[model samples]
Target: MRTLAGYTNIMSAKPGDTVEFKVSSHGPSATFSARLVRLITTEEHPRTAGLIERDVDAAFNGEYPARRQPIHTGSYGYVEHATAFSGLEDFTFQTWLWPTLLGSRRQTIAGTWDESRSLGFALEIDEAGRLTFLMGDGQGTVSTANLPTPLVERQWVFVAASYSAKDRTVVLHQSPRCDIGDLGSAETRKFDIAAVQGKSGQRHFFIAAHKASASDGLLLAGGHYNGKIDSPKLHAGALSIEEMASLASGAAVERLNECVSAAWDFSIDQGSDVFKDVSGNGLDGRLVNMPARAMKGYNWTGQFHDWRTAPHEYGAIHFHDDDLYDAGWSTDFAFTIPSGLESGVYAARLDAQDASPAYVIFFVRPPKGQATSDVVYLASTATYMAYANQTLIARDPLDEMSMGSLLVFGEDDVFLDENPEYGKSLYDLHTDGSGVCYSSRLRPILNMSPNAKYWSFGDGYLTGWLDALGIKADVITDEDLHNEGESILAPYRVVLTGCHPEYVSLAMWDALKTHLGRGGRLMYLGGNGFYWRTAFHPTLPGLIEVRRAEDGSRAWSAEAGEYFMSTTGEYGGMWRRQDRTPNQLVGIGFCAQGFMTGSYYQWSSGSSDPRVDFVFKGVNKGSKFGDYGLSGNGAAGQELDRYDPGLGSPRHAVVIATSIGHTDNMVLAKEEFGAMHWMIGGTENKNVRSDIVFFETSGGGAVFSVGSISWPMSLPIDNYQNDVSHVTLNVLERFRDPKPFSLPQ
Candidate 1:
């Protein structure tokens, strides 16, 4: 496990901008050294410029004391100003819950309890996973009314807890939405307590969790439940069983106006964090850690699949015990980008006395209107955020099978396995088995470590290759393109993408399309480019949302009625489903994928096309090249894409090369077929291959695509003298020329 770790406040910044670094150490008072570096390649491959980074002088390059910062992981709703719920002598709390987990740990249902003082009432699942009504007097005494039957997992249950000061009596009700014929039944559990004060304090109320402590308007809570909660209500009086049943049976709040204290309708704000208490008491609360919203409520019908259409049916919010939106760490140090700092990938190198050196990576962009070079490298920051802190290889068994090899675990992977509070990737499932739709970079992401064998580090090979070819290019990220749009690309004549620009937002797409329309040349040196429809949080930096809707080669599928993103209210899925397939933009879309060894590409008939003569100028006319390199031993491996005119590939697009000799594990994407069949594996399906493509746009713009994620990895083979490097260099030099591309009639 790593002894030291850190993250940046922002991933991309301008030359004059300031960025903060948040660092943590396992041992308090530990000393560490820090410095700045411009990273070119982060991998230690023998065939490449291994672990290449240039030292950059900075003022903060000295020793400093380190401290450990804790991350509190959980999602819950909080009502900070809960004065209306204070000093209640006779009260009732009820809600509809769909429990996804039970029996392991105690789970809080709604409560005003403070664990530190033990001074309030709480409806919680006891240690034995049974519903219980617990109350504690500020002095010392505590009382509980426990139900005999433990709640069933993943089953909907309506529960109520009522207390009456008249007789010191407490009533707990657990009513399942459907008949619990054989599992267990506890329609009512009533008991009288002796010497129990049943006092309530000024402690705030919370849904799905209770407070452990509070400071600076921030809460530290525990006992987080994993499930869906909907239509939680509180009443002024200790309501009878029939009254609580009426509320649980979907009775209108107006009908019981006299007793209603707060009826929190979760359907009020689907996009925002705060929820509404519709009982007119003006009680509103905000959600912390960003739980899965727009969940199907208990009363959901099959009529509508969108929350915008039938919000009432999507009233539930699914809370996970492991949901982490932010680490909330204090910034340990900061650096202001110096004037005339070239645009590139940079990192703050940290070294502790007893640990390996750590690198917290960030991108430096050129100042506004200060384009340093004619070429720009568009970093896939959105995709990096989507894959941040991924734990699939360790947590999921299917991943090993998909890779066709036993999984390997490094120190970072082991650390992530032991520490899930760091956060999850879009490809991971929540503790409740629901797909994670939101990913934030406000925490340390182990997978994005500069030396880690993940997407971001793999893309570093291209940066190192550019340095070898003596190409000066400005660096910009997806966030910059999304926020600044086409103007960020207007200064650059040629734009080069990373190896897997998978997640794309609407603004990024529009900017790229606009760039192409204005005669901007794009070298799409990537596969699976412009695939998943993605969104950035409008108000929050370093956060993104993606939903795996209907069909895709996905780890988990979003629920039926939850295909829209809570970040932007846009439909979440592949761009193909939206009729904006990647082929329409780059002449190729994702078609096949494999994790085994890679294969080489063979020249196709279109290689002879006069339009692509410049692309093959210095390359031999042999059938096979790019058969060896770092990634899977070849250029065409990992996720592959193909040109299909039917899927919006331009009719004028030419296939320069096609990959061959893939293992059977390489299979066609799920969206390519109506149902599963034998003709889906690489051995059987002709479609399971990567196709190198080229095409021209209406303007002088043109696109050259290498439809394989591993294509760029082949650049450093034979010390950058390989065929893959030659072909890439050829295209870059031609695209750099001012001559406009002409349409061949």
Candidate 2:
């Protein structure tokens, strides 16, 4: 467990903007000190500058009281309409449910029952996974009626419960939508009672969970259900067995509309957290913790796949007990960026006397419409958010096999294993085995640490190298480029990218394309970039969504009809699937991947091309230049990209170098082949290689791509005197020049 952990509300800010930090401390000391630091590279390689962080004095740099803020996990919908059910004499609740997983814990389908107060009624699945109807009198008397058969996982079922004060009876009904012979047959149970209480002052009615407590504006929920719930209806009078069966079987309930109290249609607001009530009682509710929307409901058929086309068929809302969107932690301290502060990477350094110090990373951009330098580094913050708090090392069963070595667990991995409430990356699966499509930066992310491996920290090497070379470059995040478009980059002559910028939003893509079209230069120093189609929430900051549609190196595949993101209602998947392959912009696209080992790039035939002669001006005439490095022992391993004419690689693009000598573990990407075979491995396949390419665009713009994630990792080798560093510097110097390049005939 971590003694000190925290996160910032915003990942990037401009001058005069305040960034809030929320810290959680479990140490014996209740006080912690906060200081501001300019982050360079934290790589500990002996050949590199180690642990370089320049301290910046700040007004908020002092001791502050620390408190433990717990995270509540789970997603549900709740409506604050208790007056609708106050002093009710009769009632009925019905819903279409598709259970995914059931454990010893009870799962509420719909309820007003408060577990602590033991009040109201709820339709639920009991601890044994059987359908049950529960009622509480608020005076300590709780009653439950259960069906004999247990529910089958991953199957659709219709359930209903009713109470009649006139008859002093309670009734429950369960019916499966599929064929299961006797076990899946319809069931109805009735219980005789002297009296049934209908008045409990619980303010909120919940779906997929029941209230445990609501104190000080904080809601504590229990009995979180994992699965889909559709077309939930509540009535003011008891519904007969025939009436309930008619409602569940798609018969219209409008004939008896006078008794209708609330009917929630999840498909109404597919992109927002609000659920609309179709029954006209104004009993609308808001979803908590960001449940999965745009799901295929019970009535879905093969006719239409997208929810936008057939919303009625896709009314379901999939809720998971482990769904977490925000930590909701209170701010411990906030620092407003002082005017004229250089735009770059910064972090809040928090320290407790007996605990490990924590660094919450954030980026600072130049003031609006201002340019601090002629060059800019576009930080891949989208990719960082997509991989925040990932647990592939601890939870992925095939992780060791994929890496060709035993997985190593760090302190962060252990902490994530113990506390899943911190949420997971898009690469991970939810508790119910569904792909996690949404990610947020509102919670602590251990992998974003300056000292952590890969992810955001991997880019620090380039920044550190630039600092050492006395180059003045401004920094902007993915969000800034996305929100402002090409205007943000129009002021800079050159743009640089970090390693592993795998996630690309449509806005960011358009901006980069526009930049290249307007005589600007781009240095794509990374691999597997602009591959996945990503979306940022239109109204929510620091949140991103990605759906793994139709394949291309994925941890989990989205459902067939669920390839569209609920955030922007855009199709989610690889950019290549939409005919926008990365090769179209950078002269290369993702080709292959391997872990913990890398290879070197050999001079290709195009090295003699006079157009790219400036790229190798001061470099040695060696056949290969990136033979040694810190990451994977070489500069051309990990995930690699290659120039391919068949996949939109510009015909005039020069392939100056190609990586060679990779182990068999480095296999070709799945998208490269339709059939699986042993020949696809790096040892047998010629396609599994990285290529260094250069091409000139219209308007005198140009692109220089080093198609390897390990390219920057080789910069600090030999104290930044290596061939990789020299070649990169050569390109940077020429790109920084104002000379316009003529298109090759």
Candidate 3:
């Protein structure tokens, strides 16, 4: 912090090394300005430059003192002499620290007071997110063009640049954003400066943003809060440009919530001293609302007791059609709770299927006197609309063996492939599915099981599996539920389901819609459930229906490939898959199938970040060293189906490869991590296919759906007999029960 008394010292910086710096705070009283330099020499006076400069603006709270000139700095620039010095070409680039995913990410300087803005200032970042140094001849000054990346978001980015013919690239690192949770922008590039080449002279450095320079390299772009720059860093030698960019990728893939979990034991037995245990979900499972399984004398009146009442809000993440939903993405987890509930300790269990050896459990205890908000509800299928439309079904006969069961909707009607944007194919275009797609070299998470119904989203035999875990979940028919869209997923810690729980009634979807908005949690056990845009019977109030594409096809017709260049190698935009901007809401890219049993899995060796990966309990650097390695499946480390084809940067999403397979298949993977997370992929059972994904939102609730259903029976019941089932259960268990401080014990 030496005041520049006219002379200058190079400080602790070398030609090829990085150093922190800033302009000395003494400009108004002194006639000279302080500046940083690339180098200082004797003959001809070598001058240091390569740094950005500007007058502090009113933005970022920078302002000129009364009766005094304002200090200027807080930008990046390169050292360039243009036509003023020797013909030698030499230039340096310096950057400012910018956060990517948190806080006021953009840099600001003083400006004319902005009445519209409370702070009276504006915010900004380099256009492309990166600056460049172009040094040639008389036309030599450095020209910085901002480069853009999908994951850099809006934030501050500091960079240091130096040029060398051997390797023309500047070295830089993306710093941590507002929170350690967000990884910063991680891209870096190299630039060759032809302006300051081998010029032999004593180079002098100037700063304090003196007068504008005609020969020194600088950008004319305006600033928000132009003020004297604060702590700065300078680097000698060229930094690895590519490495820097890789870092930004990490921030892009980070997830906000670890997971969520919830469970309840109804135990609703009456006429006994233990009547407080309303919906008797007995500790061991003997007393659920099992019409036939429970003792005849037990009363079923309290089955819904103690559970968060009707019309609950199930928090969920927003899912724009364009988001990445396949393998390996992350986002926020949220859901809504109903307005009326007897205050009690509640836990949201997040069971992330396929994530073995680790799980997440988050808990929430409502205020001591909190009451239920309102009755928000939704339908699960179009047939449910018939019931909501006032059509009623005869009560099931509790006395005789039930010949016909009530359709969960309580009415008679059916939804036959009714959503206009629904795209129905045996295979997913994003991955190599089995039929009706291009580059059919291999299947991508395809449901190849021969016995499955054509595009059917269900598989039988989920009871044994559900009971195996001792989870006292209700098996209410889809139509049995009601919703106002505001009653997301009321009265439940998390909405649990079997594999292939597709065929969502419009109300069911709307209920989920409310859950996410209100901050509920969700966990999809299987694939391909709730992938359509069905209609909730507004008139019926609680009925549900799907809107068909009107085409002879199975209602679904829009394809991600048709609307995006993603099918090839560039994922310019995939959100069109569901007509939503995924990054804005959900965090995944797409859904695929074929992650196999006994596949490999591993964690990134990049950095020891426990927050993003505490789920890897007991696993470490040396453990499972070869787990996520490249496999015979080229897709393990690279692209599988090729939609949005090219490798998405770490920022937008990351392939936390767990296992590789033949035909470029990575049996396991993890993707986007941020305010919201989308995990959508598929599987097949009995030759039928299904898919389900989780969309978590900013609040802390989520929605779980899948395209496949047969898997429930495959994994739930067979887990004891096979490793795949065990793995799936383990993963889902964790997702269903996430932890806030650490992985559940």
Global lDDT scores for all candidate models: 0.86, 0.88, 0.26
**Per-residue alpha-carbon lDDT of candidate 2 for residues 389-420, written as tens digits (9 for 90 to 100):** 98988888888877888877877787888788
Question: Compared with the true structure, what per-residue lDDT tens digits does model 1 show for residues 550-654?
Answer: 888888998887898877779999999999999999999999988888889999999999899998767887979989978789899889999999999999998
Candidate 3 ranges with C-alpha deviation above 4 Å: 1-463, 476-488, 501-510, 539-578, 581-586, 589-609, 612-659, 662-697, 702-745
TM-score of 1: 0.96
Compute the lDDT for candidate 3: 0.26
Clashing pairs in 1: none
Candidate with best TM-score: 2
Model 1 lDDT-worst window of ten: 194-203
Local lDDT at 653 for model 2: 97
Q: Can you write out model 3's per-residue Cα lDDT over 206-254, one digit (the tens) per residue? A: 1111112222352221222121121222212332455345324433211
Order the numbered candidates by TM-score, best leading: 2, 1, 3
Question: How do the predictions measure up, each by TM-score?
Answer: 0.96, 0.98, 0.28
RMSD of each: 2.0, 1.6, 32.5
Query: What is model 2's C-alpha RMSD?
Result: 1.6
User: What TM-score does candidate 2 reach?
Assistant: 0.98
Clashing residue pairs for model 2: none
